[model samples]
Target: MTRHILIGLIALLPVQAAAGTIGKSEQVQACVLRQIDAAAPVADCVNEAQTECLDLVMKAPMASVACFRDARDTWNGYIGDRMAHISATAPTELAGVAGIEVKYDLLQNLMQCDRMIDLTLLREDPSEATEAQKARCEATATALAYVKLLLQSRNLN
Candidate 1:
């Protein structure tokens, strides 16, 4: 029994680290930049914070929604930085940046409309969770859009 307890405690060490990871913008930047330096795909970093938040919350829905929101904001920041770099270095890419911004807005709007119908209409008792779910949908969509932009930025270099 003591051995089992000891193993369980040891397994949770990473969980403790993950708990402190979410909402730290600097951490997200470092994770992405490290992957870029290593020539690994930075796509994984886009979801790193969300994954850590989900692990910390044990898959609770509301908490998962918050994770998506945090992921959206962090990814957005990274996307903005990348775009600014492209615009500064390659001024000819202004049209490309504008196109990406339009696509991102459309992606978020479409996702919220399509995925949120069930939460808002089909549920027997629609509570505040419905709005929260919609918000999560938007955030998830925005993160997805940002991921695409970040991937494209790789080709600009």
Candidate 2:
């Protein structure tokens, strides 16, 4: 009887993990699209677009990290290439606009959190993370929450 119960529990693990990941992915995508629509100016638009792309990277299921990483690298590369072209061709008035730095350090930190989530998903072992990793992940999550709030505030104006 104990053996049968253990087998059933083990079988349920994959389903639970998949369900949690899918919910998170959907949430990330929804938040991203909303941000894109709220953004103003070309720079803001691109930054928001990149954020959306990163959200996809971070929210992808752990079972699919390789695919997610590939897609993200390609997407970020394309954005970089396009920005280079814009830099070469843009009018002087618009040139400064292109270089406007978005909050990238914060975004990268958030992506790291997403990567940690991917690891957790695959391991089914959230407790495996070191204390430092946990603190960094929590900080990233808090930053993202604040950024989302700031974006929403812009919509009000």
Candidate 3:
């Protein structure tokens, strides 16, 4: 899992450098789309989109969460479609194993992010910003959760 995270973080480095001078959503969208051709990890692609989106609206927590909405939605789409895809493609036993693994990933992702949000809310004066932060964190958790399933499915091919 740590290796997966490291690879994902490293994969984003070049995209991040290239995007440093890009300030428009159009440009960011283009760069993210180009990641497939570049053969970057999908986690990197999703993280770049969310990070850049958040950076664009860092001053407003709610707006930052709004920026994350697209990434969150995209990840949700991936998660939503993946199980059926796996079931249809893999041998039944492999599909069942992958299902269990993906479920574990999903649980770990949400629980860890929830832990963070809970910690934030534990502060004496939690506010709207705290809620917004929670939303963004959930977005990020969802964004990162699907990479393992994605890689696993690809190997099934």
Candidate 4:
């Protein structure tokens, strides 16, 4: 009887977790949309979206893995669209800087998501993740720093 009850409880765990995740994802999505609507410029919108998205991903419960993946993909797509616009509309010299800055911001946000995912995954299964996860996280951080440097260089010139 005890074994049966244990199995039953275990079976319900994932569903309960998923429900909680969905609720959190909905909240994050609303926040992202609100920030996007309030932003005055393309850069500001992207930045706000990225920040909110990262916050959501980092804070979401472990059951929200799928939600995190979806959020990352959505944010990446948005950034791609904004990059195209920046390329065509921004001033010639500043266009590259703007694009890099935007990419950096997006990537930095992604790294945060990755870190959260890694930490969550580790909590669930510590021995299974590849070393590459850490490497990717570090590389993204470095690249983001370089992007900042490029923006600063452009400003100084």
Best by lDDT: 3
Clashing pairs in 3: none
**Highest TM-score: which candidate?**
3
Better of 2 and 3 by TM-score: 3
Residue-wise C-alpha lDDT for candidate 3, range 50-121, written one tens digit per residue = 665667555777666655655555555555455556667767777666666666676677788789878876
Clashing pairs in 4: none
Off by over 4 Å in 1: 1-47, 56-60, 93-115, 118-120, 128-132
User: All models: lDDT?
Assistant: 0.53, 0.38, 0.58, 0.40
Off by over 4 Å in 2: 1-63, 102-157
Estimate candidate 4's alpha-carbon lDDT, on a 0 to 1 scale: 0.40
Residue-level lDDT of model 1, residues 58-154, one tens digit each, is 3466666566555555555544555555555554545355445535554555566576667567755664455455545555555556555555554
Q: Candidate 4's residue-wise lDDT over 84-109, tens digit each? A: 44445556555565555554554565
TM-score, candidate 2, is 0.32
- RMSD after CA superposition, every candidate: 15.5, 18.0, 10.5, 17.0
| Candidate with better lDDT, 1 vs 4 | 1
lDDT of 3: 0.58
